[model samples]
Target: MIDLHLIGIGTGNPDHLTRAAIAAMNAADLILLPRKGDAKSDLIDLRRTICADVLTGATRVVEFDLPERDTSAPYLGAVEQWHDAIAAVWRGKIAQHLPDGGRLALLVWGDPSLYDSTLRIADRLRADGLAMTVTVEPGVTSLQALTAAHAIPLNMVGAPVLITTGRRLRAGGWPAGVDTIAVMLDGDCAFQTLDAPGIEISWGAYLGMAHQALVAGALAEVAIEIIEARASLRERHGWIMDIYLLRRAVPVA
Candidate 1:
């Protein structure tokens, strides 16, 4: 049986790793790092850095090319197929590296419980008849990093917070009842699609990383600035991962 450790490394910050996560890394026999092409090579590099710092065990670090998803197909279908392909790649790597089945580790960005799909892919491995035991080491999520960077609470004292994707924000506009919204996985500036009336936004890109950028102000005041800044940053760095929080100002009764 393979002991699979899904370790959360936390939004690119090595310092964000918990003691438990570090211990798990040091205990793994093999650790697999996925390279998502030249545009996102920094992600692989970050994994390497973390391993170098925390992994004291005689763990073999292997790097594999991550398969690109087919965007031409329908969205949900395409993602499902992509996940299958990733699982196949993973299976091959594990079988080749640990034919006898041993402990393995994968460094996940942010918390796996958040928007990441590492857990789902792990489930696929189990479904394929792989004898594996999965363990999750939770780390600081992007929401925590974003909120900390902005020095703002995620929700009002007694109000609920709605966490969603940029696509949902675009398709449904502002969700009712929930005054605070945290948007992730947004390739486009979905905030531009909403009416900026009484809305405030706190946006952060490459959170917890060295090249972090943050912008906060009334939506009407900083929406264009954030767009131009994000575009320029993406062009300069070749890739970008960003999250933003939006809150509607409570009307003075």
Candidate 2:
């Protein structure tokens, strides 16, 4: 049987790796790295850097070109098809390199339990009748990095926090009865669409990596600044990953 390990390496920082993540990487017989494209080659390079930093054994490392999702298709349908394609690629690579069934690992950015789909994709492998077992090693998440970078508590003194995506935020507006919201996977800067009056924001991009950017202030005052900075960073790097937190002003008791 093949033992598959989905190891979270955190946000592209070698130091973010946990002791358990390091041990898991060194123990694997094979590690699969997926290349998104030249524009995002830095992602794969970061993975390599992490491996170089922690691996101390004779584990084989392989790189494969990842399948691109068809943005033209419906979102859910496109994702399902893309996951199938990825599973096919994984099957080919595993059969070619480790036909005898051994421990294999895929380094995931951020915690897999978070907004990441590595876990969902892994489930596809099992559904396809691959005789494999799965294990996870959690690591630092972008949410943690964002909060730490801002030096703010996630929730205000026992207040509730809503973790959501950009699309939902744009579609549903600011959720009622919640003081805090953390947003991820927003390409359109959906916060711009909100009618927030007394809201404040703390935003971070490339958290835990060099060249990280941070901005915080009243949402009305700094919304434009954030949009400009995010655009410039994406233009310079060809890709960007960012997260933001919003809190409505709390009236004094």
Candidate 3:
């Protein structure tokens, strides 16, 4: 049986790795790294750096080319297809590298339970009859990084906080009954779709990394600034992962 460990590495910063994460990496017999093409080479490089920093044994490392998801297809269907392809790749890699059973690990970006699909993909492996047990090591999420960077609390006094994606915020607008919202995977800066008034935003890009950037202000004032900055950063780095928190001003009783 292959013991699969999905270890969260936390926003590409080696310093953010937890003790459990380090132990799992060292205990693994093989670690698989996924390369998402030239544009995102830096992401894979970060994983490699984490491994180099923590690994202290004869653990083997392997890199595989990740299959690209089709953007033109319907989002759900496309994601399902992509996950299947990825699971196939993982199956092949594990079979090739570990014909007999062994321990394997994947360094997940941020915490896997948040917005990541690694667990779902691992489920696919189990469905395929792969004899493997899974273990998870939690690490800091981008949400935590964003809040810590801005020195702000995630929620207001006794208030609820909604964590969502850029697509949902754009499609549904601000969720009712919640003053705070944390948005992720927002390539389009979906905050622009909101009414903007009475909303404060704390935005951070490349959080916990060397090239981190932060911006905060009334949404009306900084919306355009954020759009421009995001575009410029993506142009310079060829990719960017950012998260932002928005809080609508609560009226005085």
Candidate 4:
């Protein structure tokens, strides 16, 4: 049996690693780091840095290429095929490295329970009939890091906070009943779709990392600024992962 540990390493910052996550890394027999080409080489480099700082066990480190999703297919179908391909890669790597079966670990970005697919991929391994045990070590999430970096509370007192994706915000518009919404996986800046009447936005890119950038103000006031900044940064860096929080102005009683 292969004991698989999925550890969340937080958003690219070495300091964001938790004590539990550190200990888990030190205990693993093998750690798998995924390479997503040169555009995202920084991600793998961060994982290596974490391993260098915390790994104490005789754990061997392995690198594997991440499969790119075929965007020509429909979104859900493409994602499904992508997950299967990734599972196959994982199986091959594990079998090749641990012919006798042993413990393995993967460093995940942000909390695995959040918008990440590490757990879903792990589940795919189970469906493929791989006899392996899986465990998760939760770490700080991008949402938490964004909020902390801005020194703002996620929601108003006695209020609900909606966690959603950029696609949902773009397609369905602002959700009702909740003034606060945290959006992820939004490459399109879905906030631009809003009417921008009483909405305020707090946006962060590369939260908790060295090149972090944050901007906040009335949606109408700073929307263009964010767009320009995001474009410039993406061009300079070749890729970006960002999240933002939006709030509608609450009326006074």
Predicted structure with the largest TM-score when compared to the true one: 3
Query: Which 10 consecutive residues of model 2 have the lowest summed lDDT?
Result: 116-125
Task: Name the lDDT value of residue 190 in candidate 3.
Answer: 90
Instruction: Write down the lDDT that model 1 would get.
Output: 0.94
Candidate 3 lDDT tens digits, 1-253: 9999999999988999999999999999999999999999899999988888899999999999999999999999999999999999999999999999899999999999999999999999999899989999998999999999999999998899999999999999989989999999998889988898999999999999999999999999999999999999999999999999999999887
lDDT of 2 by residue, 67-120 (tens): 999999999899899988998999999999999999999999999999988888
lDDT of each: 0.94, 0.94, 0.95, 0.92
Return the TM-score for candidate 1, rounded to 2 decimals: 0.98
Q: Write the per-residue lDDT of candidate 4 for residues 58-113, one digit (tens) a residue.
A: 98999999999998999989999999999999999988998788889999999999
Superposed by TM-score, candidate 1 places the C-alpha of residue 185 at a distance from the truth, in angstroms, of 0.5
- The per-residue C-alpha lDDT of model 2 at residue 160 equals 98
The digit string of per-residue lDDT tens for model 1 on 43-150 reads: 888898998888776999999999899989888898999999999999999989999999999999999999999999999999989999999999999999999999
Pairs clashing within candidate 1: none
Instruction: Judge candidate 3 at residue 109 and give its lDDT.
Output: 91
Clashing pairs in 4: none
- Report how far off residue 117 is in candidate 2 (Å): 0.8
Compute each candidate's TM-score over C-alphas: 0.98, 0.98, 0.99, 0.98
lDDT of 3 at 241: 94
Rank the candidate models, highest lDDT first.
3, 2, 1, 4
Model 3 residue runs over 4 Å out of place are none
Model 2: pairs clashing at backbone N, Cα or C within 3 Å: none
Superposed by TM-score, candidate 1 places the C-alpha of residue 147 at a distance from the truth, in angstroms, of 0.3
